[model samples]
Target: MIDYRRIGALLAGRREGYCLPQGLYNDVDVFDFDMDAIYGTGWLMAGFTCELPTPGSYVSQMFGKWPVLIVRDKQGVIRAFHNSCRHRGSMICKPGSGSAPRIMCPYHSWTYEHDGKLLAAPRMGDDFDKSAHGLRPLRIEFAAGAMFISFAENPPPFADFAEKLEIYLGPQRMDRAKLAFESTISEYANWKLVMENGRECYHCATGHPELARTFPVTMSKHFDRANDARAKEFVDTMTANHLETEAIEGDWWQLARFGLNRGAETLSMDGHHMVRKLMCEENQGYVGSMRLAIDPHCFLHATSDHVFMFSAVPVSPTETLVTGKWYVHADAVEGEDYTVEGLSELWTRTNLQDKELAENNQLGVNSPGYLPGPYSRDAEMLALRFTDWYCNTARAYLAGRTAMDAPIHVD
Candidate 1:
């Protein structure tokens, strides 16, 4: 049996400025708890609006154990629903992108509208209520052009984070963008390892040579920007260009715009725009990359020419699926405006390197002599924050569970 109290204690016992206990990385019970407590409760980035361009367009994917189907209705509204059919619980949509006038269950021919209303149920009695058998709906919200869904009964407020996303990403005009390319890679590492590796640039200099060519790795290190002349100058330049320069962070999200290396326009091998057409109409010259991170699942980087989105999906106790999506102007043609190889090279290489690193890290942690080590105070602050958030969230969930399990006295 899993000991909830012991798990809570383990989370609460984490030392500051250090990595988590070894068991937290490889324990099956801990992984299951995380699926329920963390990913289950948080708002996850489902997909972008461009993925479902026309009415009836939809994409289905598994968020933890929840099969999510996101679709555009006849009225042009984006909607989400549990992919399972209302009848015998078969999946209405397969795991990928497709288009259909209505969702149909291949097993029994039960059909549902794009808005999740039950439309046709053959061979059912007149007493059967179609209204009562509609598909189960999930809570969904949009920020900029991306869709976020929460499985929680009462999810956290997204208004503030949505506002921040607009401030940083709205300028990109993602509504007019298209998903140019996408790829998913399986890593033999825990989800936390993949996230911890992404939350910092401590390994970029030594591990990602291609990314370092254009990206300013030092900008990721935590420091007092107000007193730093370089930071002040960059902010001034961006402000003069009518761009957002400040960084905004909350408990579960962070958004910031940072300058690239000198003479670099975007994140590319040649330091030039990959797409011939710019993403934002007002962008006449170089505009820094706007980076946004939503806790527990995804991170996004939008440049003047394109946007790159990354999401880490937990697969098992010792495995994660890291998916990358690249978006560019909808009118931009593949060969004429941008090539897939050029558009995805920098991040593609970096992700592969990080995958190897994370797998190796997990292997070391699985050893008997493995112990938590100190995180670099300056370089690994983001990683520290992520770890802290995970522990705090887990402890809160465990505390709630304990309270519910406790015996009540007669009044």
Candidate 2:
């Protein structure tokens, strides 16, 4: 039996004693995951359940090291396929997203049914068994209205992942949602840099100006802002001083059942105040977003009237293509002149700041003397949780463990 208690103790000790050199930023070896790291196992969010609204509706993309296509069969089941045609090696679906009665290979024109059964190969003789040439199906499961696909045959059910997350994000908002807007970006920094920056609010006043203003960034004031310039204008107009949720570890953050893991810099230091809106529910309403990064690429964020989500699709060690999806009351998104610009702008500024910092951070880490400093216990406890997760999970995976040990809290 694996001794989890011992492993937990080992991880706890490792966290306190460890110091990561800046070189990790430039280490492409770790950033480029092994074939097993991505395709060998585990669940990855492929799309939203609502996205595939009809049978034969299909979307294709390269997920991790694997090229994948997903479709909803007439049976109302959402299924995933390898997306490669069996004969002559060709891609089956050409569009990023679409609706089709069946998948047709662009190269040889091999047709596949929505269920992935080989329908017909024109040039092939009748002697060729169609059953042997069907599309390779991938393991897929759905939960919390989200869709996920896995290469592992016996991976944990999708419900399990949802259950684990529900503990952090209350059930109310988790179930109700509607699509709003989305965007994508290719960055020159490793995916980890983006993720780590998003998890902590310590840099808000400095890195993200527009963000620091609109969001409840500082649990304190007179603490020089992260971007002292941006936070300046909205500082006073913040009509109702941010009404923080119950204090968890003296951090002035309200635990919203979820959050983003991609990194960001706070536009610390108040600047110009923009139009301020009141969303007061007894003076405590939706201030901004509560974001969480769930493992690889998936980000969940909730704001007052809607939620903005992001996914970081890792393309290379220094490049990541991102995708954003906005959801609001189904009715709220349309039936009027609506633009996703205001929402996209916030993320745009946030991303631009992170790009500047992370690229520099990447260069800095290249210095042999560079070292990542420790997080303050109170202000950065959440970020620490990730450090623990990263170190321990990587070690366990490298050690040939089939399952990750549950997190053991540090004193």
Candidate 3:
């Protein structure tokens, strides 16, 4: 049985600016709690609209324990479904991307139309009501060409998030972008550790030399940015160029634009354009990077030449699936404009390095002597923010569960 009281105590006792307790990182019960309270309730970036470019296109994946299907219907409207057939709860779509005129359950041949209306059931009696047996639908929304979904009946407000996304990502024209390359790496680490490693660049200088070539490692230090003349000048230059320079933050999301290292246009090994076709309207390169991060699951970085989408998904108590997708202009040709190797090299190398680091961290955290450690205030502010958000959200969830489970007496 899961220990909800222990989980609540751990969350309530978490120290500010320190890493989470060891149990929070390696406990199976905590993992289940996170899947229910965090992943189950929040909006997650499932797939891009470009992945569903045409009518009948679809992508299916397991969001925690929920089998989610995102599809573009015959009317070209993107939709999300629970991905389960109503008859026996068997999954209707296989994992991965494909184009299908209708969703068919391989187990029982229960079929559904593109919009999730039940079409046929081979063995069911004529009295069966197909209309009431349609696949279950989930809440879905779109912003800046990216698809977001929620399993919650009443999801958190999205208007503010969508408005901020448009301000930061609209100029990139992600709707006109196409997936150039994609990869998923299994990291033997806690999902929080995977995200914490990504939220800070304290390891970038020595750990990710390839990424450090184009990305400024020092720019991650929030305290240093205030007094750094170069950082201010970079923002000034970006503003003078009429680009979006605002840094917007909310409870569960952040949107900001930052300049890359000198002479770097996009996150390439050589600090040059990886694709011939630009993503935005900028005539020249060096448009900098626009970053958007939604807590717990999604991170995006868009440059003038291309865009990168990342998601850290929990597979178990100590395992995470890190998926990365590289996107370029829709018209970009493989050999002439960009090669898959060129478009994905920098991030691929960086992701592999991070996987090793996170796995090692997990191993150490699993040790008996493990204890939470303090974060560097300057370099690890974002990491600290992530932990704070986790604790607060988990506390709220546990409180609500307690209230719901409490017995009632006759009044």
Best by TM-score: 3
Candidate 1: which stretches are off by over 4 Å?
A: 220-228, 281-283, 407-411
Q: Per-residue lDDT tens digits of candidate 3, residues 1-411? A: 667877877776677778999999999999998999899878899767998888999999887667899888988988899988899898888779989888888998888898899999886888989999887899999998888999988778999999888878888888898888889999999999999999999899999999999888877553246566866887787777777766778998988887788888888999989899898755376677888888888888899999998999898999998999999999999999999998999999999999999999999999999889999987889889888888888877777776666532211
lDDT of 1 at 309: 92
Residue 266 in candidate 3, Cα distance off native in Å: 0.9
TM-score of each: 0.96, 0.72, 0.96
Show how many residue pairs clash in every candidate, following the order shown: 0, 49, 0
Which prediction has more favorable lDDT, 1 or 2? 1
Report the C-alpha lDDT of model 1 over 1-411, residue by residue, as the tens digit.
566765765676677789999879999888888898899888899878999999999999987667899989989999989899999999878889979998999999999989898999999988899999999999999989889999889788899989888887888998999999999999999999999999998888899888988887765454335776767887888887677877778888888888788888888888999999999655464777888888997888888889999999888989999999999999999999999999999899999999999999999999999989999878888899899889877877776676677532211
Query: Which ten residues in a row are the worst by lDDT in model 1?
Result: 402-411
| RMSD of each candidate relative to the true structure | 2.7, 8.5, 2.7
Model 2 TM-score (2 dp): 0.72
Clashes of 1: 0
lDDT of 3 at 173: 86
Residue by residue across 107-184, what tens digits does model 2's lDDT show?
878899899899988979979899998999998876556677877777644555465444333322434454556666
lDDT accuracy of residue 89 in candidate 3: 90
Q: Each candidate: what lDDT?
A: 0.86, 0.56, 0.86
Weakest 10 consecutive residues of candidate 3 by summed lDDT: 402-411
